[model samples]
Target chain A: MTAYSATVTVRLKEGVLDPEAETTQRALERLGFELDSLSSADQFEIELDADSEERARERVTEMTERLLANPTLHDYEVSLQQR
Target chain B: MTAYSATVTVRLKEGVLDPEAETTQRALERLGFELDSLSSADQFEIELDADSEERARERVTEMTERLLANPTLHDYEVSLQQR
Candidate 1:
């Protein structure tokens, strides 16, 4: 089996209530930083031993879609690389 | 000023006790996933308008070091892109 690394980014889609993002934006403004818009996001990095890079990508994608991300409110993307 | 987007990933440094990572590793093992090691991590994406990309990077790095991450147990990396 090949060793693989995958990074998954999960974020609330546009127009979602992101209190953390809101708070950060306000805080930045207070610090005199200008921002047009802000959104809150999270990421996960998983290391896996799989048959191939393709297999690792497929599995990570399935995991994100099925468990790690909320489809209705969150969008996710997975990137897999051979290690 | 340039509009910029920054992503900061915070993770427990090596040798640190990471309960979340431990739990995830066990869960993956239960599901028959082959993982050599697992690390718990979190990501934050910040959008900022600053005088330049350099300024945004500097500010975000400061935020991560000062408030967003625990220096003793956590390490963070920041990436900035012009928007």
Candidate 2:
């Protein structure tokens, strides 16, 4: 098995209300930073041992589907690097 | 001014405790997914008008320093794309 690092980024589906982003934008404006809009996302990095790159991707994808992201509200992408 | 999109990724500094990631790792293990370790981060995407790419990056960097991340515990990177 080879060590692999996977990054899963979870984003709110477009049209979903993102209160955290809105609150952050408000805070930035208060600090005199100008921005039209802001959106926030969560990314998780995992280190694991897998047979190949495809296996690493598959495992991480399943992890997102099962625990890292909510399919109903989140859209997630997984990327892997051999380590 | 040009429309710009900035992505800022904030990660915990080395040795910082990340309870969220630990909980996620445990949950994944419970579901039969094996991993050596896991870490979580926050990413912010900002849409704004800026005079140049440098300006856009600067504004978002300030945003991270001021509101998006706690400097004592987190490190952040800012990247910009013209939109």
Pick the TM-score winner: 2
**What's every prediction's RMSD, in angstroms?**
2.2, 0.9
Q: Go through the candidates in order and give each one's C-alpha lDDT.
A: 0.78, 0.92
Tens digits of per-residue lDDT for model 1, B7-63: 888888888897876786677667766667666577777777798778888888887
- Provide the fnat value for model 1, as a fraction from 0 to 1: 0.56
Question: Which docking category, incorrect, acceptable, medium or high, applies to candidate 1?
Answer: medium
Native contact fraction per model: 0.56, 0.97
Candidate 1, A1-83: lDDT as tens digits? 98888888888988789988788768767776565766656777788889878888888877677666889999888888887
Judged by lDDT, which candidate is best?
2
What TM-score fits each model? 0.85, 0.97
Q: Write the per-residue lDDT of candidate 2 for residues B1-83, one digit (tens) a residue.
A: 99999999999999999888899899999999999999999999999999988888887887788888899999998989998
Chain A TM per candidate, in order of listing: 0.90, 0.97
Model 1 alpha-carbon miss at residue A64, Å? 1.9
